[model samples]
Target: MASDYWDRYFRRARRMRTSRRRFLLGSATVGIGAAGLGLVGCGDDDEEEPTATSEPGETPDPTATSEPGETPDPTATARPEETPQPTATATEAPPDTSAVPTDGSYYSQVGEPFVGITLDIHRGVSGIAGGVEGSAYSGLIRFDDIPAPTFRGDLARHLPEQPDAVTYIFDLRDDVVWHDKAPTNGRPFTMDDVRWNLDRQLTRTLADGTVADDFTLTNTVFTHIDSLDYVNDETISFTLKQPRGTWLESLAFAGFMDQGVAEQIESDPDVISADRIVGTGGYMFTEFVPDGRRIAERHPNWHLRQAGEEVQYFDALALLDVGADVNAVRIALEQKQVDWIGGRFQRQAYAPEFMQAIQDANSDIERLDVPALNANRALIYSWEIGPFSNPMIRQAFYLALDRQLVLQQDFAGEGRITGPLPWAFTDWALSEEEILQQPGYALNKDDDLQEARQLWEAGGGEDLEDNIELVANEPDAVRLSEWFTAMMNGNLGTDKIEVKGIPGGSILPYLTGEDPIAFLTPVSAWTSPDPRQRLARSYTTAGSINFGKYSNPGMDDLFDQAAATLDRDEAISAMKDIQRLAMTESGAGTILMAAATGRFLKWPYLKMEFNPWRLPVDERSWIDQSDPTFSGRPSL
Candidate 1:
């Protein structure tokens, strides 16, 4: 087991080294431009340069897969009623690989007679990477350009039609087609594909009517669904076990897994490659190199464009990871290798001078803070063991944390006071103005400290006589955790919370083990901006991701009341009550701290659609290399 871990570690170290070397060498050669990388077919819509050519590289040593250990559902819901003729033609012409640009990923004509621009942004992610998936894939329902509570159907003509609270139906778009490749050569996408995607997350049973032993439950949001039945070739229906208002919103969370290669790649890691991923989206999957880059080139016959929609300006979309270490991300931004940078989770460390220099050089660049309300900071206690078992101690622990210090240390002082939810979902969340008045989030902390100490003493915290291990998950949380250990001790006038920093992945096993520790981690508290969304994922008794194991009968009742209601106001009332119960009215066991707002230094030339959902790089995000900012990019 340790050997497998080290095997991954050394392989990654090697990649990081190679990435740094390439970036540094590229940085030194500023004038190389797209020309140096052998870019071909940049575009002629605005009459630009050209694109490039490369073999599709599939990484066999995959550390992350679609859903680790997941297999296609063998339940066989229904056979395809009919097979429609495939549409959406791919570019018959071979790729034009004339010149090597300084950034080869910048220009790609893998499957394109497309817009000439190529995008390169900083991204550090596992699996196929979000940009590759989001760009190539089409979901039943999708978030619009904005990240708020706005969404529209992509494959479906509109949001599913709900005939009853427990029943929903989707109207598929006839023109949508699978990407032109292998088993499914640009065939019209249909209802069957939707069902396959749905079943990927649904619980599956063997022919013996027993739940499969190793079936991967990729997502639990679909658990409410009782059954999925085919209505017709273009129509599908879903039956729910019970009525849920947020069910439609949850469908927005569903992404279509291409049926084209279901048998070949669904459960096979050996063949799973980001470049080989096929979907009906703005961009075609091109390539993905771990810790180096991810690329998706323009799809000439993308359904939207086939419908004569004016979208997807960039000839190709690229995410250059370099190495996720803070320096690599910062250097990419500093050198203009990326058009924009910053997010709630990303640990961005940049000097003011570096930012000022960009403004000095590029008058078109803009820096703005985007609220990712769901990306909230949460305090989850080990309620089953130790001091955290006591509610008073739990509350005391939460009350003593200096949120501002976490903001200052981990986020470079660019964040908000998150009590339970981030402020982005203004409709369903407590505003920063209101949250500031909460006990721990208040501008002044004198009363909060006094109460925390009193509670600590009253709860027999001194009896433990040991430093309470507090887990801080993720890199940013780790930085703030080290500082909070000292701050918390000083606040209580006694040594108390000790920082136990761990990677995000390790938090699950540590928390779910024989003796779990209290943890602080980032939660997508605003998954749907539906209050029940968070409750279902993390708060309720049956919650799939409720790592803390925090539960209350009253809280579950509130969720039921909200889900049963069709009245928006009534559901919200119940939702707010649940939020109140999380920390305001009750336990120290679980504290929701709304922390961090994302700030991005965006170049004017980047007309990319950046939303908080999935990865920030939207396929349709406009990229105009002809802009003055493009000419201003670092050249060798």
Candidate 2:
């Protein structure tokens, strides 16, 4: 199933590459996924083939060679049969010094890498605002390496392991310290902090009858944790309600806060004001100008830094609020007003002309593009509401959409038409042939529309009000929503569809309400590499982010079984079943297109680590200026 999916995807990718050279050199840039540039392709033919399996207790190296047309299967990585106990140990392996030049002259010319970045702060910074989660904050565990999902100790000393499938123990580094800010006093990070943070999500109410404002609002991911025990200052344990195969992957969402800060917020929720939010990350929050800009300075006491090493490659980080206008963001990058721009700001790939302008404006700029995992544009229906309440109506709406036309007209043929699961889950995602086999996704628009018309007539026809509103938070979403509205009206002959472009803040209230029948939204499941994390959260009856409020007992059972199964192959099979149910059986939501490969425009002088899953480069990136021709000044 997996190999067949890749075969079709790469074949489509090769077709897009015909114009790649022209798109890159000319003023206009192509959207992501245009030429298989974002998708995985075959390697050299002479490379040795990798073993299909690894030794027990060892994960197969993701970098191993593969056949020309095949990519590494993430599921082939080893899974733990039994949970490993917490051990107070640290891997003291030094950073790969071989990558650095021995001359040290590059560091001298660069001075300090002061990178200025701009983002659409409309999502708001996490902890300070109510809506943002892991996307906006650095969690306890993060995907240290991309394409492989290899995790390294971030806040914790090492990755947590299950003693059994039901229990997980986290061994935190004793040296991790809180920022030298108020309330925290630069104290050593402790298990109490982890316990308090976890408890905020698991236990909503305190023994004293006060509410715990978990602040993060990711309690849905922790619903499986039956209880948490503060074993010691350096150890914390989580007892699950049931076995979960993706429990370790779920830890990536466990961003920690000081116990004192958490308790104070529980007492006075207002204590979590923008300026008061605290975390023990590489960067410390300095200032936030709402809807304008936010700033963070390098923390002098980051625990990850090696002895005698520079505290950080960059002295400070800036997050500018460029608003919802993509053109304004482009202008900012061209003028060198911001050193880099990516993340949600670059969610949609640009037109060829826009790309040309950026290249023409600055020769020093470089593009870093990668295919997004678990990120896609989707049409979300309000299952609990009026028109969408009828499954026939929902199915009719799905069939009415011409996905291929939308991909060409709006996306410039840069996106792949996908199902509920994002293309990021390459191993389990259904192939284009398989996706089209599902109702409404077929290539024959005439046949789909004819079926949709029949379904609509059968589902009360004219009695069902065709009048519906589609809301979008971002510019690209608005464009997609507008295109969909036209298609439904023109093709399906439903003239009552309306499109509304609203601020990101207003999205939740609109979707969770009874007014809007459906909305076009950009959804992502990149928090963890595990498919269960997304499957359970987006489809289950009690899913936290199930905005449409979709519910199904059978589907829930499938997700639960997938989560409980420890074997990789079995878990994958279960996840595939969940996708099949969601796409073929439930029809709860329609995935419009897989997320386009993201493009990051950076100055040549900026030296940064690239992670397709992460954007705008994090704090670990540095600036390099060994070349005599380049200067730190803005090129424009």
lDDT by residue for model 1 (511-590), tens: 56777567665454232335555555566786755666777788788877877776667776776677667756433245
Scored by TM-score, the top model is 1
**lDDT values, one for every candidate:** 0.51, 0.51
lDDT, candidate 2, equals 0.51
Report, for all candidates in order, the number of backbone clashes: 39, 8
Per-residue lDDT, model 1, residue 112, is 17
Candidate 2 accuracy as TM-score: 0.67
Which digits, one per residue and each the tens of the lDDT, describe model 2 over residues 367-410? 44444442344677778777777878778777787777755653
Model 1 TM-score relative to the real fold: 0.70
Query: Model 1 Cα displacement at 572 (Å)?
Result: 3.3
